[model samples]
Target chain A: MYSKEHKDYLKKIKLHNLLVKISQIFILVFFLVIWQFLASTERINTFIFSSPFKVFETIISLYQNDDLIHHIWVTVYETLVGFGLGCLIGITIASILWANKFLFKVFDPYLTILNSLPKVALGPIIIIWGGANATSIIIMALLISVIITIISVHQGFTNTDENKIRLMKSLGANKWQIFSKLVFPSNIGTIMSAVKVNISMSLIGVIMGEFLTSKAGIGHLIMYGSQVFNLNLIITGVFILCIVASIMYYGVVLLEKKINSKWD
Target chain B: MSVLKIKDLRKTYHTKKDEILAVDNFSFELNEGEFVAIVGPSGCGKSTILQMICGLDKKSSGEIEVPLNIKIGFMPQGDSLFEWRNVLKNCLLGLELTNNVTKENKEYVLNLLKTYGLKDFIHAHPNNLSGGMRQRVSLIRTLATKPDILLLDEPFSALDYQSRLAVSDDVYKIIKKEKKSAIMVTHDISEAISMANKVIVLSNRPCTIKNIYNIELENKSTPINNRKDKKFAYYYDLIWKDIDYHV
Candidate 1:
């Protein structure tokens, strides 16, 4: 028997959810309208600020010229390759650290230092080591993402409940069994969190790498646009980067939701 | 025939601050299918005894004799159900760990879940289940290994009063119906007296067996029946007094 209050409560929840969705879209559009208005009114110099219309037209031109897809693809490919490798290497290293407490202890301080150190500062060194190519860009992204992934994922593996591990051990489960069965499954949320941060870190590294050397990609477009004072192209590049980042972040969110629904 | 035997078992923790002895010169025998409840004060190292029996903890000095190396299943406090695993998968954990997750074993576990009133919740995750149901799943996971003995550590403490009584009955019935020997460590005296065929009372820190009571009540089928058997209160009081709650 669903009472009136119960029915009302469920309806209220549905309404609240709808309201949240509408408000989120409203905020984005509101910001865009304000920006366009400011540029049109000349309150902000359209020459430098670049009106939304100019940005849109710039995007259309880039699309028509076929450079837009190429640039986006380049950045996306580099980021994806770097992100995948970084996560794989990072998780593998984290597993090694988790398996050997002594090694972890030896590397703990170094890991901490690496995690805190500004990775972009090593750009020149990386360029020297890997050469001024996609190699350096991918390495830069890996450096930015991998150390943080190691630290975060290792923390997750190590922070797995001691009680659960004991329970597994008491069952005569071996070290690998404990890792596969208990530690990894229990830390899915933590690992997903690391992945989210790792994505952003990798993006930052990719953009930074492109800023220094890349002849293609959204980052290069932004840099080149600024050199020639084509503010429209710069703003358009910024918009594209924002859209790409949002898609990737939302993709991770979708993955998290799928995993949680299936497993959690 | 006894499935487990422990004599002169001792465990001491040597730390920087001091040497702390947990279980001290403990000895016990668990015959096949004999339900033993180890009741003691909180922090009396009752769980330590179970851990030592399970070989998860090292003993300083002891003699442990198990004929043919009997399998032992340990269910720790807090359901400890993997939140990520659904009820059926959680139940299958032990079998999966032991590499015994065959078709027959899967069916057997699924049947066990069905018989234990978890038929409807097979696909539900641990978080979706009530405390009692999760505890039941934990117990089922332990039992799936087909161990000669079960070691449970205050599994029902997480449930409310009503659910605790109901689940204790359910667990007791399953244990008896399956002819399983169980050594459950709990601070609840009445729980020990009601569910156990024999109760071992342990003393405070540097814990050792203070007294052992062979519970006898005619027609005592389940823990719920044990409560109605008139002698429940007497055993509860006796063991309550035996536990040394002192510094």
Candidate 2:
């Protein structure tokens, strides 16, 4: 009887999976169809609000001109650099803070105030310190991502199971041993979630920096297109940004799966 | 030789409001290879005694003496297994902490994991295991430290009734096999009688030792088996009344 019920439950899950995939595709096609129809019929001005077809044509033209890869590479490189540096510096500082209670308390109020401050307001200052090159873009992204990482990963490190720490002490584990064995491993979930949030936060910073200064990248393309009244280019840049962001987010998910499989 | 001794042990918690006495003038001596169970009314600071004994918490006054270089392993109320680690790695935590992760210690832990029913679950995460299995993994982790004495604080109470019985028996067998002195605190009267060689009963808050019983079972068997020795129920009632039960 249990086996039969289990079989029926598995069949229900398979059906649910098939229906979900079908609905996803159906929604995308339905949206594109309505968008293309409205633009082609001139119900919406194709000049200001470009159609899906024009956006696709714009992307293909950019590809033919070979600027598409360059623009994408520029943004991807900036985001990757900023992400790596932000996470590294954030975690190191957090570890140092965790190792010293006095240092953490001294910095606690300042960190809270800085985290609440709008980082975009510091974009002009970043240009002054780092210049209008890739360095400044990376700095802007770091400003966006690092504070969140510090707050989150530090929270994870401090919020480990106290009982387990006590157990370690009973077994004669010292401070460093307790931190590495108990504090670090127990916060794996928190760190992964922080990684997921950091990716998007860094992406936003890069795009905002590109808007402020860059002559290339998807963000620059959209800004330039708006100035030149090129609606197709603006729409196309936005489309590529969405796709790129999705891919990067999925990459973090895949990394999460790999790490989970390795550790857990 | 006595592995552990506590004389006039007292623990006072000083909060922002005022100081509260948790455990007051409690004392006991544990011989090598002895199994002692501490039973008291709920919220009577029984676990406080184990914490003081294991040096996890500070005592207000009195002495908790142990032989120098002697290790103490403590299993807390919850399973307290490291959730990120699989059973094997979790079992190795104590050894890893002390830099005692030698080949011999690893082999001993592996043997313990296999000898118990956790052979198939050696690769499984603690979240994936049943409560009984998690507690067994926890016990193995403690035993891996090769502590001269073990302090268990309500270790099996988190489990359901059936798993609690099975786990208590499993734990009893493992403690016996390891030949380590054990001091366990549990609220269950029958559990105290079934597993412990001696039982220590405690009064309500400002806890102090009220009475100690020398448990005797004729068959000398597992915890489940000892329950059938007819002396179990008699000792159970005696300790139950010893506790400050208001109802």
Candidate 3:
């Protein structure tokens, strides 16, 4: 049961949400249509610019050759492996650093230097060390994502309420009890946000790794396409990458929602 | 009978530059079922004394004596409730930390919640509670540990004025009804006068006790009611002057 005004208000909110979704789809379709029209009519150079239809044809051709799924899977597998291991290593290192202030202080400058350095510059070393395979790609991804995760998660742990720590200490909580019951649980939101950032970083690192070395991922397809002057293949590779990245990012968002729901 | 005693307590905080003496020669006694308030100007070493007593902060030099069997509970300035936990779980946090979550302990906490009018919200999170309700829940959380002496550090300072008065009244009643000893630190002269059985006025930075007043209101009931007692104004004036108000 509801009042007339309340029903009207609910209707208005639903209408607004629908309009927003429609506008988003409209913008994407409009861009694709304009791009397709320009390329088909030769107003733009289709060979270089690569029309939407050409990209679609390229995707179909790759699917027919049974290369599309394999390429997408390779990139996704590398990203997930690197992301998962990166988060685990980051949390462990952060906990150790939090437990020993002297160790944290000793390594502070080194972490800062590593974080600020462009990780891509180390691609040659990583390829040499891990030997130019999926291993190298995953290693590169870990290098890119692990440092930032450690910094952010450790910051979150230290930023827990001082009074809460005092209360725990007054209650005769030992160090392990304080960390487990207070510090760790309170920083779940921080850790989740770090995960969100880590996924994107991992993707970037995987793509860069594939560009330098690897034969079977989307990044490798783009590299091969550019070297052979196949504009359609390059555009198709980028489109697939976009789809994969969005799916992975949304997956993390859903996980975060699930975790927060338990708290509230 | 005195349950706890402090003698010649001192604290010195060291920074990169120099050390600052926070509390010097601070000594006090808390009896079995007495409510004492320590009031002073802001930034005084009043809270430092409570911290030392509860073993949250180490004293540079001091003697704090209590029977080994006596347990102490602490309530910080804000409610300090873990928002991720529901009210009942929050109340159980101290017990959980101490690894004493027995069936009788759970039932005792439940009884406290029911007695304090929080039975309906036993499963609700802290954010869902009002300011007054949050303070009550915080007190019950302290009470849940079954401590003989409660150390309260500016417990109501986080609330707005309206809720501060009401929650202080509520907390005073709960403390009295539970028959537990308490030592509260605050900067409010009137709050000390109305609620405390004994008020210790502290001096500035290197805190020392200026004077201790044993309140004798005509009808010293709950805090709000005590404020209306004939002698409340007289004690308030005396303690107000005793504090070394820097500003």
Candidate 4:
């Protein structure tokens, strides 16, 4: 009797999961059909908002033209460099602040002000200061990503188990040992979550930088396409950007899973 | 020579609002290879005494003298095992951190793991293990450091009754085999009676030792086996009475 009930329970769970998956697929199809019908009917001007088919055609053409790879490489390089720089700087600052409570208190007001301001608004100044090169884009991306890393890492350091810290100290573990073994390992989950958030922010910073001032990159392609009223190019660029960001987010998620599995 | 000597130890927490004395003029001595258990009420600052001995917390005023060359191992109330490291890695963590994981030390730790019935689960994560297994792992982690003195702060309090008994027995055997002196803190009178050679009973807040009982039994036995000894009930009653006076 128990076995039958357990089997029925499992069957119900499977059926419910299947229903959710089907509904998700149905929603996606519904949106796509509506979009296709509206574009074909000219309800929205094709020049202003290209059909998915036209965008796909543009993507193929760009790929075939060989310029797409160069643009993609440039964007990828900027995002990676900016992300690395942001993580390094943010983690360093957080460590220093964690070690020195007085320093954290001193810098608290400045961090608040910096985080509150919209970093995109500084695009013109950043370009002027960094000569509209990769430096400007990197600076923008760093601005977008660094605050998150600092806050998350600082919180991770602060939230380390007090008893564990005490235990380490009692076992003759020095300050550095405690930080490396206890503080850092315990905060891996928080740091990974912060990295996931930073991926999209990094992309946004790069695009914003390019949109304001760049001769190349997907951001430049979108800007140029918009100026020329080539909505297909713009849509294609947007789609590629989304895909890249998703891949980066999922890559970090995979890494987090791999690291967590060892312990969990 | 006494392995550890505490003289007129006093600890006070000075906050903005007030100064609160936690441990007041407490003193004790433990000879080499002695297993001491400190039992007290919840807020009696027994932990403060252990913290001072381990040098985790500074005593406001007191003197703690231990042999200069002797090392100390501390097992806190919580498991304190790194959740990211498997049992083997966690066991070797101290030696790894200290850059002292020599081949011989690794062998010693591995042997302990195997002998303690953790051989099959060496690669298991702390979260995946049972509470008793995790506590055993924590003990092994501390023992792996090869300290001369072990300070256990309610190490078995987190375990269920059955697991606690089994773990207490396991820990007792390991400590005896290792021949290491240990000081444990607990609120359980029966536990103190069953496992300790000497039990230190403490008073309420601003805690001080109320009484010290030297446990005498007919034969050597594990903690569980000792619990069945005829004198076990008498010792339990006596210690319970001492604790009750303070509470």
Candidate 5:
């Protein structure tokens, strides 16, 4: 039996929150519908702009044709392979950089330059070196993700509690034990955050690589769509890409929550 | 031989602007099983002395001599417990980090936690615990490593007044029962007088030991009870005067 005042306050807060969420969704839908209407009325050229219904129809037809699933599998395989390779190389290089202060100092400037350079520019070079195949796409993805991971993991290692390290040393713990227990656990959050950020970048790198060279994958599908002015096909490809990226991002978030829940 | 000995210890920070001295010409020694409290003004570098003793910071000049194979446990002013770790995991962190989580060590640690009334909250995360409970967990974590000497840098200063008193009594009973030597840094004169067998007062910045007060009070009294002792006010007045003079 809650008091009327208390119940009213709760009701008001819930209503306000619901209204805010509804307004956001409404605004997004309104813009999409306006775009769809404009494109369907021929106010915008169908070559450059497709109605939302046409995009949905194309996705349905693509699924029915059965080629979409194979392309999706190809892209997914390339992304997963690239992500694994990127994480391994990044973690190894980060550990090495953390172990050697002199190495970090020597390479710091060069790393900044490399990180600043647009990774897409290297698409041609990566293709030239690794061939115009999945290898090139994976290599391109690694180039985009590795630097970020290395920086995050290295910072995590360097920023571990000095007092904790000293305490471990006093307990007869060697350098390796300290690193394994203290430094590694402390950096889990940072590493997870880096992973989430890199998932999107890895996908982008793979797609760009495929766009430039691959005969298979969603990137090639989108390229074919653009060549024939099939805006619906392009939109369908873009929608699928967004879904994949969201799933990957949310996957990392879920993992981070699971790991962090224990500590929290 | 003393369990710990420091001679002419100095620590200075070299910066682009000017040379800053953190701990200058500080020296002291601690006997085994002794509880020593160091009291100083906020900026008097008391923490720097503890940091140097714990080997967290390098000494600019001096000799710190100890037994060849001695273990040191340090509790910093900050909680320093990983927010991600549960109370039990955090308490076991020192042992885990040292790879010394033997069954005996774990039993000893758990027994201490039980005795300290934290058994029920073992699985709870650090954030879920109260500030006082978190501090207790941190203290247990340090003690679980089975250090020869424990360094506490204002361990209870972060707690509320009531919790501070309760935790201080629990901690005092613990250190005594464990038969461990400890050096605690505190700005609270009453806390230092109540918890310590010997209170070392330090002068202003680039600190040096000014006076050492050996407290003789009713044994086994909590810090709050100790405050009511006749000698408590006297010692407090003396420390307050000394600190005021330096300021």
Candidate 6:
């Protein structure tokens, strides 16, 4: 049923995509082999660099001790909580700002200042106020993510097509009706993008909070390992963190795709 | 009977640096089932008059006398159909906004889609529609509200040359068939001559009515066919010369 030229073009595209995938895996494997080879040959210090095999061994030992799952769970839980609260508060505040132009104008400079200031620098103060607990860690994430969400989502709300707004007003729609029917629904993609950025920001804030005053978590594990000079534990913690971050980011991406498709 | 009348309508826009008078002493009237096209130079406040009529923009000073029973429907420049909504939902937007979506209203909107040859694409999104089809859908959306007077603000300007002609023909037929009075704002003089019963010309910035021409065509059926009328070029030249075009 297919034409020959079209079939050939499709095959060429598939081959190119397969090559890219293979190259990605090859690079990872090459890096692992070179690092392992150098450490074994004593060209690099294995104790400091912590080769992949040693990191894997450390993970398995930690798993046997039942500490691995608990630490991972702690960090994941904090990140999830922080992310959820940040999105809710941010969107609520954005809606409020969109509703009242005066409030938006008054808060404009304050929002900019809060957004640009380093949220990590507030970790010590957050610990002092909320104490060394999970709540403080969630608050830290909320602080980091909420301001950005408000700024981006409000921008989206205000950037709705002027003609659409005029159409709505021409239809005799009230302010609340316009916001619900036109502004909010049209900005779904914008809100989803803000959610994506917010998820990563929450994770960063959670890790920083963990570093300041956490008793358990991947951040604490890495901090404790560094203090004890256990490079293997530190490397293992970093590896687990990378995996967790990737999973969360991709989860958001999948959700964004689902929502965009529904809208389309 | 006159359905709507505006007397000495005025609009002034204020910015930080200066105040600009957009419309000055603009007065017109719409008889029942009449099509009036307002044509002027670019930025000559043609659209501001339509906006004030629809109450989208507040008039600085004027008397707009519309019978309390008459509803106003407005079609903006582009289709402005919501991407998330299908053709059916987009058409129902006006009724939905007015909280008048009764079963009869839904049936009325559905019938309009079917009558206008949009039955096959009722469930299709706006992005999938052709430019001409989108404009037709936009007109159907405006007609769905059953307004007595329609305000069209450069409705065909967004389409390409070919589709703009086709869509204008489509829109003219729809308005005439529905027996609704309309005030359409356009920069295209040929479009004004062909589609409207009367063409109103205005002067540049702080615009006022320059001249009004009652277009006399030998045989005027649709916008496309009317373009071939012998007198079409005569009216076009008159309106073209009426607008003050300068650098």
Global fold similarity of model 1 (TM-score): 0.91
TM-score of chain B of each: 0.95, 0.96, 0.98, 0.95, 0.93, 0.98
Please list the residue runs of candidate 5 whose C-alpha ends up more than 4 Å from where it truly belongs after superposition.
A1-32, A39-41, A64-66, A262-264, B11-25, B57-72, B97-99, B216-220, B244-247
lDDT by residue for model 6 (A62-172), tens: 999858899999999999999999999999999999999999999999999999999998989999999999999999999999999999999999999999999988888
Span of 10 residues, lowest total lDDT, candidate 2 chain B: B48-57
Tell me how far the alpha carbon of residue B81 in candidate 5 is from the true structure, in angstroms, after superposition: 2.7
lDDT assessment of candidate 5 = 0.83
Estimate, for each residue in B1-247, the C-alpha lDDT of model 3 and write its tens digit. Answer: 8999999999999999999999998888989999999998898888888998888889999899998888888999899999999999999988998789999999999999999999899999998999999999889989999899999999998999989999998998898899999999998888888889999988888888889899998887888988899998899889877876666
Poorest stretch of ten by lDDT in candidate 4 chain A: A255-264
Is model 6 an incorrect, acceptable, medium or high docking prediction?
high
Query: Which residue pairs collide, candidate 5?
Result: A263-B84, A263-B85
How are the candidates ranked when ordered by TM-score, highest leading? 6, 3, 2, 1, 4, 5
Better of 2 and 3 by lDDT: 3
Compared with the true structure, what per-residue lDDT tens digits does model 2 show for residues B1-247? 8988889998888899999999988888999999999999999899888887877888889998999977888998789888778899989987887688999999999999999999999899888999888999999999898888999999987788999999999999989988988999999988889999999999999899899999987776899999998888888888877887888
Fnat per candidate: 0.65, 0.84, 0.86, 0.81, 0.35, 0.89
For all candidates in order, the CA lDDT equals 0.89, 0.89, 0.92, 0.87, 0.83, 0.93
Q: What is the interface RMSD of candidate 4, in Å?
A: 1.4
Model 4 DockQ reads 0.61
Error of 3 at B167 (Å): 1.3
lDDT (Cα, tens digit) per residue for candidate 1, span B84-137: 888999888877887889999999999989988899999998889887788888
Model 1 spans with C-alpha error above 4 angstroms: A1-22, B120-128, B217-221
Give the better candidate number (4 or 6) by DockQ: 6
lDDT of 5 by residue, B95-190 (tens): 786567899998988898898889999888777788777878888888888888999988877788888888888788878888899999999888
lDDT of 3 by residue, A1-264 (tens): 999999999999999999999999999999999999998889999989999999999999999895789999999999999999999999999988988889999999999999999999999999998898999999999999999998999999889999999988887889998899999999999999999999999999999999999979999999999999999999999999999999999999999999999977
Cα lDDT for residue A171, model 2?
75
**Per-residue lDDT of model 4, residues B89-137, tens digit only:** 9999888877889999999999999998899998888878888788889
TM-score of chain A of each: 0.94, 0.96, 0.98, 0.93, 0.91, 0.98
The top-ranked prediction according to TM-score is: 6
lDDT of 6 at A171: 80
Local error of candidate 6 at B110, Å? 0.8
Q: Score the docking of each candidate (DockQ).
A: 0.63, 0.70, 0.87, 0.61, 0.40, 0.87
